[model samples]
Target chain A: MLVSYQTLRARPADAQRQAIRLGEYQSHTAGLGKGCLQANVVITPAAYALDFMRFCQRNPKPCPLIGVSDTGNPDMFTLGADIDIRTDIPAYNIYRYGELADTVPDIRAIWNDDLVAFALGCSFTFEHALLEAGIDVWHISNNSTVPMYRTSIFTVPAGPFRGGSVVSMRMIPSERVDEAVAISSRFPLAHGSPVHIGDPAAIDIADLSRPDWGDPVPMPVTHTPVFWACGVTPQAIIRNAKLPICITHKPGTMLLTEVPDDADVPLFQKS
Target chain B: MLVSYQTLRARPADAQRQAIRLGEYQSHTAGLGKGCLQANVVITPAAYALDFMRFCQRNPKPCPLIGVSDTGNPDMFTLGADIDIRTDIPAYNIYRYGELADTVPDIRAIWNDDLVAFALGCSFTFEHALLEAGIDVWHISNNSTVPMYRTSIFTVPAGPFRGGSVVSMRMIPSERVDEAVAISSRFPLAHGSPVHIGDPAAIDIADLSRPDWGDPVPMPVTHTPVFWACGVTPQAIIRNAKLPICITHKPGTMLLTEVPDDADVPLFQKS
Candidate 1:
């Protein structure tokens, strides 16, 4: 059932967290956080904030920065009225030396003043735009994660970060490709437009059936595989960098911010 | 006489010291720097580089970043094969603590490693795109600087930086506004699209006739003033920050880089 705009708007950031906080709704926030902007979270020591911020800036397609918390501060007011970085997210992925250490619902116990939390715009925000445009998102239809892949296209390197671009694949029907691109392009804060269309091999993906992460959806004969720069990229990259302590939202889990879906940032509305 | 491409190509960055480097040919480089991308330059201490870079990222349309040299490094290889930040720009404006100190042809003597240079994509790059689409940039026709203004839009604050957006205005026939927007949006690396289309006061400009900078051109009865985020924004922002040391190119002067005018950066080519 589709939620009414009034219903969605009535749910505050804290109210949306109630179900998750009480363990009644710890699942993915795909549809529950309706109309509010969701984000890919990354918390790292201030020593790495500069480089990581640069990395995000350099590769905005995969890491569209929406907000940055003050050093060691858990609040992300820029993203919302009172976003608590420590406990607002439904789940957190702890990484040590670029490897996943554990998955937890919150990081209150580990939160520190040296840590700066970055809220990067996520595709979930744009998926709403797509759905509104009456475009079918394969993963949404299948009730599964979007198939993602490691591509040969390397992102512009910054400091110790160097890796091939990672893309999330969506099978949009041929006629809808233009519409999909047009709508997604409006949300530059959320990856913004397809990186590759038609032949996947051109970008170095050997097989469409075998994605690097998440499940692959069968491509319909009428559909074309539209690839978008994925938010998962930074997790893969910072992991490879082997930072001593880094925290990110676990895949499928995200940090919901108070930024309205209609946030008037021109960059988000480009084209 | 126009310098032949063959002669300009063989000339090395180190050998090209002034406007005469292009074989005594100095005609505003409007079409002369073909293939060689030109950039707006801003130099500041490392302490301010991060904030300025953040400011640029936040205000991309007005200050789209192309490259940032490593702290104290004069040779920004990413922008050009051997371009020196200190002398590549044909002219420079030295500002000290929020005031213009001098307009100099070169700053080699004052160059230091503690200083960082930022290369921002210029509207000149996207003007090529607009021209290709058959849009007339009025200033180009009249051979005058594009009219600019300080608007009511305030940029997001970072550290000591805060100021209204500085926009360059263009008059386009009402019928061509869509084409102008579609063509320019392809060059997000430059100022992507018109920030405002119809009314001047919509963005806080009281009178279009009296522009804050550049010569104002009359809008034909059938034309509309299409405003675009201008590269002069960073210069205005850095000036407002009142940093002890800041360097920027003169209004018409810019740093020429090796990024081909036709360089296939996917972001600029999309759509």
Candidate 2:
């Protein structure tokens, strides 16, 4: 059954997750699960889990951890009820030796007792707030992935995980930048405020037309290009480390959580 | 040289840490490191580090991680400059099988490549904010250790780390409770807002006089007992887990970081 944005938006978070789990929906989760928190998923072996968690802790803006699964436990019980990390997301990206090995609908075939899953906050939550505040999120309206670039800003090293921050760019009208910043700042888990504004050269990005990841949208002279630390960062770092195996959610496909977008409390406490 | 509160307050955080490292200071860090962030330290072997990190992530209010040392590395580089986790703190409590085995001024003799150090946010930062807001911190005024209790609030389990939350009690006037909460909420790293406010029995505390740790303060009728999730929570949980070996800072003694109390950025980004 094909799930439309209208139909998915009307359903509760668990039902949305259920559809995704059952393989009824397998597409980008944008505009789906309205008002719910969506997370970037990263699964790794127990050996690398500590360092990955430490990397996230050291670099919170780009890697805000919302939930971490118990080692070898496929169920992310703290993230939401009946959340099986092995199968819930729309799609999975399997990386081996730091390269994209394959993309699959679910990870049940590759599931192992030593794997640990992490749920990181994504920009979808704060993007909803921006739109609600009457701020234009250019890429959303243009139907393109938010442009992302590798910046010169180096993330603090944790074990073998270390890399420059990957940032998502949004061009906001000059008059509304502050308002957008304030609204986005409220969702620190969602990459928070802009790390760089106006000048791409300041952060060592040479060109606005080309991005390291995602599609670039039209940049208007009346607007300022704002860059926020992107959740894709960890993936880049993980790839650099050349780990034996790692699994992550495909870009734009996120795990929709029962947690409200504005929840201040940790997800585990809520359950 | 005996470092008085007045003299220590005038010195920078690194200097204060140096004094502690040199054995010139060996008391509670309560009044020291004014305007800087203080942390509760916990060191465990690499085998237990992942679960401990998960436990802290699961129970953030009580275990707000300020810095995590690279596995087998004693220097908490992200937290501050020249932070030798081995000897920077005033005192250390070595626990064997979760039993307090010794109290030492430093852990240099036992430091090994397998140990992972974690610096968690302590109440001192928020306490300072509370005091700045003109709120009376009863324990500080009385020169007593803040009374802490094991509440019925069970922390979300992570591996072997699971126990009820241990909370520190502060008597705030009934009218000022809201103000105190608002002030402390600004410092999420410092245990944030009170977990429980008025009645103690609701959280399963039988008496006000008896505390599991720290000294009991005189309760006044004019003030209501406010409880904030305490960092001692991890210690309690660690003790319950009975790990083969663990090390923690003595109660009241804390690691002072170069990060300012008002800084919202992750500690790693600062240096």
Return the top candidate by lDDT.
Answer: 2
lDDT of 1 by residue, A44-138 (tens): 88777767876776678888877776677787766665568877776788999998999887788899878988888888888998888888787
lDDT of each: 0.75, 0.86
DockQ class, candidate 1: incorrect
Q: Model 1 off-target regions past 4 Å?
A: A1-24, A32-37, A70-73, A129-136, A171-187, A193-212, A215-226, A258-271, B1-38, B75-83, B129-135, B172-187, B196-212, B216-226, B257-271
Separately for all candidates shown, the number of backbone clashes (residues 3 or more apart, or on different chains) is 3, 0
What are the chain A TM-scores of the candidates, in order? 0.89, 0.93
| Candidate 2 wrong stretches, greater than 4 Å | A1-7, A10-12, A268-271, B1-12, B268-271
- Pairs in clash, predicted candidate 1: A72-A113, A98-A239, B72-B113
